[model samples]
Target chain A: MRITCPICGERDRREFYYVGDAVALERPDADAPPEAWHGYIHLRDNPCGVTRDLWYHEQGCAAWLVVTRNTATHEVLGVALASDEKGEAR
Target chain B: MVELAPKSPLAGLVPVTVGRMTLTEVDLGRLTSVAPYRGRDEGLSEALKAAHGIAAPEPGRVTGRVAARASGRDEACAIWFGQRMFLLAGADPDPALAQYAALSDQSDGWACARIQGRGATQVLARLTPIDLRPAAFRRGHTARTELQHMAASITRLGEDDYLILVFRALAGTLVQDVRQAMQGVAARGGG
Candidate 1:
C-alpha cells in the first residue's frame, strides 16, 4: 500500500505507521461512566473489508493521515490528514 | 553454455540490510528532534547502547532521536546506531563491489549512527549508491548519499560501512527493495 504525504512526497507502504479505525466514535460527556470510556478505548469493530483508518508517516514528515484502505488487501484508496478531513464527510 | 552477462547500472553497489529491531520511532504528532547520541567511544557506549540489551553488534539497525550535542567537542548532527557512536563527517562513502554511491551527493557526510560496526557490508547491499571499496570508507570516513526511498539519514562508517535511520514503518519493505537491488546487481554479474 502507498500513501502520498503532502510534505514527504510519495512513499512506499512501509513508511507509514498504521493506527486503528479512523472514524473514531464521538466521546461521551466527561462525567459519563467508565463503561463508556472502555467501550471507546477497547471495543473495536474488527471488520475484514475496507476500512477508513488513521495512519502516520512516522518516518517522513510526521503527518497524521486519514487513509481509506481495504483491510483485506491493504490497498490504499485515499488519504487525508485528520485536520484536512475535519468537518468533511467521507 | 550461455555467456555470462556483464554487470549493469547496479554493479559494484552493496546492499544494506537490517535485523528487525523494534526502534523507538519519534512521535509523529509534532516536529521533534530525532537525533540519538554522539561521543568518542565511552560516551557512545553510554548513550547509544543497545536498547534491548543483546550486545548491539553489527548487521542490525536502530532508530533513535537525532539532535545536536548539548556539550561535546565533536559534531552537531548525529544519529545513534546499535552501540557505536558515529558523527556525520564530510562527503564520500565506500560501497560494496557494486554501485551504491548514487543514493546521495548533497548531504553526504551526515554521520548519524553506527548500527552495525562490523559486517556492515552484508546489509549495505540493500540500498545505497556508493561503492564499498576498502580504501574509501576505511574504518572512519563517511559516504555520500545519492537517492533514498524513505526519509533517511545514512552514514558510511567505513569501507562497506553504513549506518542509516529510515522511518520505522517502512522498515519491512525497504529491506525487500534493498534485497532486490542486490539481486539485480548480482544477476548482472551472472544471476
Candidate 2:
C-alpha cells in the first residue's frame, strides 16, 4: 500500500509505521475517573469498513498523518497531517 | 599528549566508475541543520537570504548551488530535508540564522557522495523506491528515503547527476550498496 504523506508526497507503506487509531488523539483529562481512563486506553473498535488511523512517516518526512482508509478493501480515502487535524479538532 | 587527525568517512574508498556512471565522495563543507521555530519560517528565510544569499527552500526542493569548491566557502546550498527542516551545506552557516531557527552543526554526522554520468538514474532506480524519472523528480528535487534499508537524503543536482547522503558511520555500506547497483546496471547494459 502507498500512503500519500502531506509533506513527502506518495510513499511506499514500508516507509510508514502504523500507529493504532486516530482515537489516540482524544485523550481523557487527568482528573477523569479510572473507568474513563481505562476505556480510553484499552478499548478500540475494530471496524471493517472505513476507519481513521494514525501513521508515522518513519523514513520520509517524519510527519504523523491521520489516514482515513477502508479496512476491507485497503483503499486509502484521504490523508492529512496530524498537526493540521489537531488544529481543526480544537 | 596524543595527536588527533580528522579522517573522511570514505577516506580509503576510491571513486568507482562502472559503465557511464561514477560514484565519488563529495566534500559538502559545514553541513548545518536548520529548523525554524513555530511561526518563524519567514523570519528564518529572510535571515538566511541576508546572510547566505539563499532562501529556505520549499518542500522537496533545493536552493542555491549544490556544488562544493576547494576555496571552502564559495558555494552553498539549502536542501529541504524533511517537514520544516533544511540542511545548509557547502558553507558555514551565519550566526544570525539562530535567532529564527535552531541551527545544529551536522558536518561530522553525515557523508555525501555524488553519482554523475549518463546512467545515474538507472543505477539509483535499483536501490531506492522514489521515482527518479525527470518528469516526476526534476532537478533541485530532494527526498529523505531509504536507500536499500539505510536512511538517506537523495537530491537531484542535474539531469544526470544526483547527490546521496547517509550517516557518516554508514559511508562504507552506502558505497558498497551503490557500487553493487552500478555493477548490476552495467551488466544489464543499461548504464
lDDT of 2 at B150: 88
Worst 10 residues of 2 chain B by lDDT: B65-74
Report the C-alpha displacement of residue A55, candidate 1, in angstroms: 1.4
**What is the per-residue lDDT of model 2 for residues B75-175, given as tens digits with 9 covering 90 to 100?**
88899998889999877888889889999999999888889888789889988998898899998899999999988899988888998989998998999
Model 2 regions lying over 4 Å from their true place: A87-90, B68-73
Please provide TM-scores computed only on chain A for all of the candidate models, following their numbering: 0.74, 0.91
Off by over 4 Å in 1: A23-29, A32-35, A86-90, B1-125, B128-151, B154-191
Give a tens-digit lDDT track for model 1, residues A1-90: 457655434566666788777656355569999998888677877889878788876654456788877778877778776767755655
Candidate 2: deviation at residue B189, Å?
A: 0.3
| Best by the DockQ measure | 2
Encode model 1's per-residue lDDT on B1-191: one tens digit a residue. Answer: 99997432222322343342111111111112222223233332333232211111221222222221211223223322211222222212222201211122323222123334233464464454444556444442232232245555454443433445444454555455555554554455421
Interface RMSD of each: 10.8, 0.7
